[model samples]
Target: MFGKILIANRGEIVCRVIRTARKLGVRTVAVYSDADVRALHVEMADEAVHIGPSPVGESYLRGDRIIAAALATSAQAIHPGYGFLSENPDFVDQVTAAGLVFIGPSAASIRAMGLKDAAKRLMEKAGVPVVPGYHGEAQEIVLLASKAREVGYPVLIKARAGGGGKGMRRVDHPDDFSEALSGARREAKAAFGDDRVLVEKYVDKPRHIEVQVFGDNFGNAVHLYERDCSAQRRHQKVIEEVPAPGMTPALRKAMTEAAVKAAKAINYSGAGTIEFIADASGGLKPDRFWFMEMNTRLQVEHPVTEMVTGVDLVEWQLRVASGEKLPKTQGEIALAGHAFEARIYAEDAAKGFLPATGMLHHLQFPDAPPQGAAMRIETGVRAGDAISPFYDPMIAKLVVHAKDRTTALGALHDALARTEVAGSTVNMAFLAALAADADFAAGDVDTGLIGRHQDALVAVAAPSDEAIAAAALAATDAGAPGRAADPWSSLAGYAHFHTLARRTRLRFGEENILARVSARPDGRFQVALEAPHDAINSHDLRNLLRTARWPGHVTVFEGAVGYTFAVPDPLAKADEAAAATGSLRAPMPGLVKLVRAAAGDAVIKGQPLLILEAMKMEHTIAAPHDGVIAEIATEGAQVSDGTVLVRFEDGQG
Candidate 1:
């Protein structure tokens, strides 16, 4: 085994690689950009190297800087974890020319699968089943439109070099094909610097099923069963599971063999995934599955496969890169039980799942299942860390396993319900709701599951009366420094000769609530809700506040939800409210990518006025209503949240 390896990545994947390297007694080196100077992975590695600035192009994507860092640290190998330079074929060649091992497939294999159109052609030539589509090299718009018509309406316009749903669009008719193609090409160029695209027939009720395949230097390869990544949003996976819930023995056998064959076709080495899109309109069938694409590196959801097969994928990567033979033959590998992985992202599900950034003042997870229990959390952030806009907003991956799918899914729900996060908005509530979703629990999932049930899934439930009272009590307790020692000193509106009820006013969102508190003779406090419909009686405040912290603001986690409440100062409410009107504000800090309208341009409601790119995703700022634009921010300008992007004329509607 190599004595040391450099992890050319950041976030959880970097930490993940380091963990396995440490377990094998291999020293690990980590490379970081300016934004990740204090990142968790940097703190965990045996050695760290500074590459460049915060922007990925200046740092993470700088293959030269990464190679130099590895050479300086004497790293015998470099592990490109999942993203950044992981699948870049040129980067792989650079690493190999530097006389260091690249702990993944060869550059040739990556090139074979890098472009979607070319990869599909290769798969077809290799006798691997492929979807019916246009995989030709022609790029003319008219030719592409004709191909879409040939494939029938509802064709998919996809960037040949895209992943993560960045440059993909589904056109339902010929009327929309031109616009869809233009948008897909633009996004593809912006994201991957490649404007080439392919048109494919859209599969109805599709299920995303991928097989984890590994190969070694000796031409030996094996499959690690499969993961069902059908639950997706915006074409990106949300939840994944191993030993697909409805998979049959015959179907699993056929798909696994096909995946292994695809791997062998490329003479693939190290860890890679062969993703297949199954036509689920008639349920999973041997002949209904077709090759989608092959990811030429470790996958984000590999843990689900690991949990079911009891194999260390990263360890296999290291061993294979070291020229070792396959760890185990295909016959020796076995699937034990069911496992599920839910990607926890720092995003607001209600707000179109836009990525969010903030300090993590509080973060907690349920205790891992006792020793052998099938539960694990893979994360790179801790309390006090910040989720910046410079990188992916993933918070963590929650994996759970059990003897059966039902049991494992139940555990998933319980785990999500027990997780807590504060100091920023998160999709925890949405995740919990999804775990408990009847259709999801029943395993009737597809790419459109979230969209079909979006209203309920993204609905933010108002905090209960008990929860509000708990927050009030916690807030008052936080304001009193001597409450722990002298309970009476914490009392508000208390008299020397007479007893009176004390009320605390608090603001949660836009509603203000009055909480009445009284000191009981038994030394317990009773909190009553006085607004938003009064509670009939007071409830004892003993354990309602599971965890409370006051750092500039009050945050309390009660009943599996974290609520941040601000005390009304009666001083700045008017100013704050007045500053938030008659303008389009940037929802989050980001770079202005495009300003669609000039000052004084007349626009209709919902008209696209500008585009803001943040966290690597484009968001359109639309005109709130029919109005004349009075002012607009310039394109290419960096703006903070609440910075006015456009202001409308008064009564313009």
Candidate 2:
């Protein structure tokens, strides 16, 4: 094995590679940009090198800088952890040209499988079932429309060079084809620098099943069963599992064989994944699966596969890259217990799952597992780390394993419920809802499940009265003079005969919750809430008063309410404002990639006026009302949160 290798990536994946390399006694060198000087991966590596500025184009995407860092560090090989330069064929060639081993597939193999159109054609020739689509080079808009009509409506237009769901559009009718094509082309060009696209028939119920394939220099290859990645949002996978639910033995065998064939046909080596779009309209069958695309590097959800198969894929990658044959043959490999991976991202589910950026004030995963069993929490960020706008906003990969799929799902649900995060919005509640969904429980899922039940999926969980009281109690500052010096001064904890009453309101959704608290002679308190629906909930806060987080916004315990007291200084209250009347803008840092309207330009309500590219995705800024653009702020520039992109004139005819 190589003594030292450079990890040409960042974030959790870089941290992931470093962990494996450390176990194998291989030294790791981490490359970071300006924004990542204090990143977790940098701290985790044996050595670190500063590459360039904050923007990816200025650093991570610069192959020359990465190669120089590796050579300077005397690294023997470079592991292009998935994303950035992972699938870039030219970068692979450059690494090998420098006489350094590239710890992934060869340039030839990446070229063969990088482009969707070309890879689909290759899969078809290799007898691996491929979806019926037009993989032609015809760029004529009219011709593309005709092909969509030929294939039928509800077709998928995918960028030939795209991954991670960018540059993909689903056309439901001929009229929408032109707009989708234009949007897909623009996004593809921006994301992959490849505007070429391929049209494919959209499966009614698509279940993303991908086979994990490994190959060696000795021309031997094997499949590590499959992972069901059907739980997705915005075409991005949210949850994945190994030993797909409802998978038959016969079907698994066929997929494994086909996956091996696909690997050998391309002379594919190292760790890769052959993603198949399975037709779920009919139950999973050997014949209903078709090749979608192949990921030419280690996948983000590889942990689930590792957990179930008892195989460390990273170890295999190191071994194979060192010219060793795979340890096991196809017949030798065996399936084991089920495993699941839920991708915890720093995103706002209520805001359309838009990637969010914030300093992690408090981040805690369950330290004590139920029954004291092992659980895996793979993350690269620590408390006080900021989720930068330069890369993916994924917080961590939470993986769980059990004897059966049902048990695994149950464990995952419990884990999510116990997970706690503060200081920023996240999708934890949404993930919990997904775990509890009946369809997911029954192993029935599709790409559109999230879109179907979005309202219920992203709903903020209701905190019981007891829970609220607990939160209030947790929020109470024990150090306060009023609470410490006089227990009766604290609401719901009066030691005197006549109890004091206190009122507090909390924000839930767009509404405020009015709650009244009454102190008891004992340490406990009673909370009464009057809601808009004329509903009243009287909660007991005995346990909450004794055990609650210190100075919290709110807390829920069982079905009861808890209230903590933090009597803010009147001086501080005078200095705080409830609302701002200034213009609203992007909430996080980002680059202003597009300016849709000029100053004095008339715009209607909800009209798109600008686009900000942050966290590897584009977000549009819309007009608040029908008005002329009064001011356009900082076009084509990097901006922090609340940096206005466009301002509207006051109401006037």
For all predicted structures, in order, the TM-scores are 0.95, 0.89
lDDT of 1 by residue, 471-580 (tens): 76666663344553565664555678644666677778898778766655444466767645444223444354565555645666654457777766545446555554
Candidate 1 regions off by >4 Å? 370-372, 478-493, 499-503, 535-545, 558-560, 569-580, 651-653
Candidate 2 per-residue lDDT, tens place, 1-653, comes to 99999999999988888989999999999999999999999999999999999888999999999999999999999999889999999999999999999999999999999999989999999999999889988889988888999998799999999598888899999988997898788778889998989999999998899999999988999999999999999889999998887889888888889999999999999999999988888888999999999999999999998887888999899999988899898788788788889988888887788887877766667775533233688898987888877778888888888888888887887677666665556778788888888888888888888889889888765555555454444444322235534554655434355765556655544555565666544544555556532222233334323332323243232311122233343244454644233344776677787787888898888888887776646677887777887777666698886676665665432
Q: Candidate 2's error at 632, in angstroms?
A: 4.6
Local lDDT at 206 for model 1: 83
Global CA lDDT computed for model 1: 0.85
Q: Which 10-residue window of candidate 2 scores lowest in summed lDDT?
A: 557-566
lDDT of each: 0.85, 0.80
| Alpha carbon RMSD to native, model 1 | 2.3
Q: TM-score of model 2 relative to the true fold?
A: 0.89
Residue 209 in model 2: lDDT: 91
* Clashes in predicted model 2: 24
